[model samples]
Target: MCSHYEAVNKPERLKQAFQVAMPEGAKADVWPGYTGLFIRRPKEPPQEEGVAPWREAMVGSFGLIPHWAKDTTVCKRTYNARSETVATKPSYRDAWRLGRRCIIPAEAFYEPDWRSGRAVPTRIARSDGQPMGIAGIWTGWRAPDGTIIRSMSMLTVNADEHPLMRNFHRQEDEKRMVVILEETDYDSWLDERNAEPRTLLKQFDPARLTASV
Candidate 1:
């Protein structure tokens, strides 16, 4: 999965790239060397009609937390959701069916592969050098003291036999990659009216995308 990414551009640049206004007080987070649009629930969801507005503290990092978890540590292990099983997995089933759906914006992401027994890191982004929208799911957890924590996870699907991705995903294992969406699919993917998995999955197309280092 896309464990590392980059959004080196400033928040204003991201806004200009995506053609969306920056939310008030929204700032860039570049810690861990992975920069991208960082959002909290109830505040960042889309405000347009048919678009699901982001929550202020409802969407945190790209990791998911099941509502039943006793603590937040589980989030560390859920940075991605496998599309093949997300619709049925216990931790994600309910959320995928009822709760939160979001988009994570990124200029590019990093993936590592073993080259001659040494790890080689490569950066992947659109060949056209445009921004990408990664599909995600969000969850809200309430602490004992009533502090609520919101988190999210990127969704991954089998990578196509693209030249670049093929080098990293060599096994039949459910190799994960971010769910990249096209501009025309954004509204439908965010529509509350189209919550069904089949409907949402139909909006993704790997053919239109190209990846490179």
Candidate 2:
């Protein structure tokens, strides 16, 4: 599960990268519950029928709390969605079917390696230094005060055989990594034409990534 990440880029840079205006205040490093940038298809009003659907970069809580969830507390339990079961999981199935897909850009992510008999934090990023756009799904949640808050969950795929990825995570746990996409694939990711996003879910090339304790 990708529990933490850094997205220090300001609104301008994020705008340049995605051609959309990003809500200000993204943090250098965001933990669970921290607000971060998420790119999603815009919600066009019924009156603007002819206008094209554009992408928007918005601030969203890191952990996703389904609309039907009892409270924000449930977000703590759904920060990551397993790719294999995302289609059917109660907490994620609605958004998955409704095409509430999003792209979560980050400088790097952290994980734990239990090779030494204790969990050791490891930093993983692209060797080239370019930020990665991880696949995710977003949902709209309503607060007790009748305010709507958007939240997201990163998607992960099995990577047990990945050399660099297999080294992380406990030996007893199933090896997994967030589905990182190529910059060229970002547009396709935001498009609704691709019904099965899983077809693009893949483990990034280990050769292009750097992992250190």
Candidate 3:
């Protein structure tokens, strides 16, 4: 599960790569509680036909805050949601059911390698050096003061059989990796009508990934 990552902070890069206008001041490094950028369909869709599906970038807390949560502390454990149980898990089910799908653009993500008897922080990025478009879900939570807080969580799938992803985490723990979306599926994955976005939650191509300690 991804709890730490290097966010794509350059506005021009975001605009060019994801075609969304990301606001300035996005943090370069993001952790569970850090505020980061996410790309999703605009709250109001364009009425004109023939126009491409529009996307907008917004800032949100990295950890998902359920509507029922009293505070933001829950973000510590909600950064990554298991795809298999997301539809039923209390923290993620609502977002999934409501189709709050999003894309998290990251320069790279960190994972732990324990094969050497001690944890080694490994940086994982695309072999081509482009930013990664990670599959995620987002939601809005109202605070006691009536302030709306947007938060998101990355989706992960079982990676026990993946050639590259299976090397991360502990030797005994069940292996898991985040769902990296293909460039071609970005618009489709955000379609609210796509009731089965869960089908896109699969391990990314190992050949397209590069890992360094």
lDDT of each: 0.60, 0.83, 0.90
Question: Which regions of candidate 2 deviate over 4 angstroms?
Answer: 44-53
Off by over 4 Å in 1: 23-59, 169-174, 195-213
Question: Which is the leading candidate under TM-score?
Answer: 3
- Predicted structure 3: lDDT: 0.90
lDDT of 2: 0.83
TM-score of 1: 0.75
Task: Compose the digit string of candidate 3's lDDT tens values, residues 96-189.
Answer: 9999999999999999999899989999999999999999999999988999989999999999999988998999899999999999999989
Report the candidate with higher lDDT, 2 versus 3: 3
- Ten residues in sequence with the least summed lDDT for candidate 2: 44-53
lDDT string, candidate 2, 1-213, tens digits: 788887736655665566666567666787778888888887662233232247777788888889998788777778899989998999999989888889998888999988999999999999998778889999999988999989999999999999989987778888999999988888788887787678888899999999887
Report residue 27 deviation for candidate 2 (angstroms): 2.6
Q: In candidate 1, what are the lDDT values of residues 58-127, reduced to their tens digit?
A: 2254467788989777766777788888879887887778746766777777776653465577777776
Task: Please give the lDDT score at residue 142 for candidate 1.
Answer: 86
- On lDDT, the leading prediction is 3
> What is residue 67's positional error in candidate 1, in angstroms?
1.2
| Stretches of model 3 off by over 4 angstroms after superposition | 45-53
How does model 2 score by TM-score? 0.91
Backbone clash total for model 1 is 17
